[model samples]
Target chain A: MRLPKLFKRKASGEVAKDRLKILLISDRVNCSPEMLDLIKQDIARVISRYMMIDTENMEIQISKTGGYGIGSKNPSLYANIPILDLHKSS
Target chain B: MGEVIVITSGKGGVGKTTTTANVGTGLAAAGKKVVLIDTDIGLRNLDVVMGLENRIVYNLVDVVEGGCRVKQALIRDKRYPGLYLLPSAQTRDKSAVNESQMRKLVDQLREQFDYILLDCPAGIEQGFKNAIAGADRAIVVTTPEVSAIRDADRIIGLLEANSFQQIDLCINRMRYDMVKRGDMMTVEDVVDILSVNLLGVIPDDESVVVSTNQGEPLVGNHTLAGRAYRNVCMRLMGQDVPYMDLERSLSFWTRVTGIFHKSQEGRA
Candidate 1:
């Protein structure tokens, strides 16, 4: 039973962690992964009307942030939209 | 004054009531005046779990609604001298009692008992709100499942938002054999995800069912789960008790191999 590190077995820790991270985000936003994808699509479409954005590289997540000057915190939606180009006509 | 602690789990059937009953009985066994309040209301089961269902003459709603005195509603445990039970009314619903009334009742009981353990109902609803309203501390119970952990996280957030201090976690129904086999979530995995002070891990034991049927908390019982609950009670009493060595049966080589394999899989 004494095996070396070269032949390690897969434990459930990583699986639990990965699932919890994504699930906690979705739970905070009250949205499923598919719903989040749709929301991201909608955001990208709406923003692309004014600017050329890279939807593939866009990142949307829920993060826990501290309330301003207070000892409390809240979950806020953070969206990182990469702008490839802006509309010159406007 | 006694400390009021609420045992809560957003997901149902995660051993909240069991924890409340056991912890209360454990504290009482330690000679501390303890009262377990079942706040589940219409869905009350703490009475049955504690085997004090037949002795329930007055309930929590009766005290809150001015139908009876708090002492009249309190049921003393037959086994534990200092233990008591404030059963919830099965006829009434959660809406029957509000936050302020619960606070007042708990405040009165605080002057009398050494610990008031509130057995919270499942879900983040009115019942949950009322259960936590009177608590000075919180014990969020959850199983190793993803859904249960997520709910526990949400409940922790709610507790923090409501200014609850000293929040702790208890992983219930933990299978030590599965953990040793690396199939189930380990205690470290849960602690890392939830990021709360670990209370205790109750190993899955068959004696729990029998003890529940017998209407007694597992303090004096020689079951694995009973010992775990006793450890939790000691820790709650501010003792520097080390966690039970659940991996005593596992060989060193097996653990090392399991970790090595887990890390290899992670990289892959």
Candidate 2:
């Protein structure tokens, strides 16, 4: 059994797959991908308040959502984000 | 019957040979009568990796072609009396043996051995199909790279379609320093992509290469990578062992030295 590089994602009914990953990464902090995306949006909204940033121009993409869902360990997330705080303008 | 397991990777040079060499040795060391078959055919390297190249009088082709008996082609490991190796035919093409012949050979081996380990060739060609045909289970070898994982996913889909449900993943060549620096994929990333149960993770310890080139099995030293192989062997035996922490294997000095070494290479 030779594994090729993983993730040629065919997420047909990706809800379960994506949700499982989301739970692992977030340690089940959020139950659903929709909830996680909303959290990203909410976090983005809160962070923008404390700094000079255009929330409209700010593009948010929470990607690589994955984690262990067996409940043996704490759920976690491996997400990538563009931190506007690092930007010179924001 | 002895369990038949195939170690394969979609991408070449991802340590399929090395994993077979070590894991087979680990099982053998554990007192299981193990046989490691090099199914790579024309691209055979398991013999060299296992340091039994000089002892190969008859190959898999020879057995399937009736030139020699299967027992005559099997090479017993010098280190482990219980371990044996069935080398591939370096001179023959993959066509020399088909899936049915392999199934027959494995079935025969099962009567005498406790485990049958097939070191499969790379790619999803006739060779790959032939390797998995007789496998009771398969260990998909892959590095934590985009291309390797993509091919692994393809292999998984193929295995599932073929009714080979007892499949697992062995992520090899994992570099902790790079993953710490956020430069490479984590175990989570690869497992996420493959969507299979994680069997084991072999770190990119140079000890493996030294052991491979020397035809000595890693189980002898119990190095990080060697221990990983042993742990995987346990898992294959139906134990639910959690994976070792790749981070804990390295101390602060080792990490610092590695970073400095990388910086030196960058400067050079």
Candidate 3:
């Protein structure tokens, strides 16, 4: 178990890099983790008027995509909202 | 015409002032007329680092407020013939001077000096704004730690927002031993993460602290960090100097022993 644990552990440098990547993505979009929750709630309320969404399992994040460099990357909002049912318009 | 370059980092204690002093001294040693400005008001230490703290009769506030001429406020460095320092007012706050005043001062200095290095105060506050107001370029300094890198990213974003086109990065106090041991980040790791053009990397050396304490700049010394600062100054002048081989500082026996230790750890 100890040997397996050692293999599973990551170097501290790699950990710092991964952490900064995520932190910087959020920072660039100017959206905090708390703000992300508020956005999710607002989106859920609006989407629920036409279709039911699984708010409990919804995941929303602001990340950069399509570029490898710093200034070249573009910030994009990603949402994974599961649909429960589509309401028929009367 | 002289170039106004602001050395800034969002987080404090990342060696902005030291880099400013060393680079300014190096430029002066290279026969360029250089002036170092300490923009960190109410907590000024560039004078102390440059060993001119006792000679500051006029400061940035005095120059901007019409109390003294720009030449009167400039303190000539003791060692270098062409190096000078325009220190901040320790009694005043950042609000003592505005953006336009800083711009006007830099314009006046541009007619006389070859390089005007602004040692910016930490944080994205009014002091930071005043420091970059009249600058034509920027050098964002950072360390290997996560917090410093995060703040540096923020600083780069701010510089870009302010329409700064020629922004560079300088990694300071890097511990190659820790990096070899997988405990610290490498220069490549930092450059890849920040994605900025690298200026130079200063290795962590004890001589830096000693020089800072003695109120002397390190560019005149033979230390590793001193040589790194000289390389940074050369690059600032558009010289295509290659980076110093940090790993080559170690002996061949040390490298061989390091590999053996790593293999032993792998076996464990």
lDDT (Cα, tens digit) per residue for candidate 1, span B188-247: 888876777898999887879988898877763445677788889999999988887777
lDDT of 3 by residue, B1-268 (tens): 9999999999999999999999999999888999999999999999999988889899999999999999999999888788999999999999999999999999999999999999999999999999999999999999999999999999998998898888899999999888876778889889887888899999998989999999988784556787789889899999999987888756676557546654654311
Specify the poorest-scoring 10-residue window by lDDT in model 3 chain B: B259-268
Give me the runs in candidate 3 sitting further than 4 Å from their true place.
Answer: A1-8, A34-60, A66-73, A78-90, B252-268
Per-residue lDDT of candidate 2, residues B148-248 (tens digit): 76667667767876877677899999998877655567788777756678899999998887887788877634467766887888888787878877797
Model 3 residue B53 distance off true place after TM-score fit, in angstroms: 1.6
* Model 3: residue A31 alpha-carbon error in angstroms: 1.1
What fraction of the reference structure's interface contacts does model 1 contain? 0.45
lDDT of 2 by residue, A4-57 (tens): 322443322233335434333332232565776686678667776665455555
lDDT for B87 (candidate 3):
93
Show model 1 residue runs off by greater than 4 Å.
A1-13, A29-60, A63-90, B249-268
Considering DockQ, where higher is better, how would the candidates rank from best to worst? Answer: 3, 1, 2
TM-score of A-chain in each prediction? 0.63, 0.37, 0.71
Instruction: Give the winner by TM-score: 2 or 3.
Output: 3
- Model 2 residue A55 CA deviation in Å: 23
Which scores higher on lDDT, 1 or 3? 3
lDDT by residue (tens digit), candidate 3, A8-76: 788788889889888898888887888888999999899888887798999888876654434575678
DockQ of each: 0.32, 0.03, 0.48
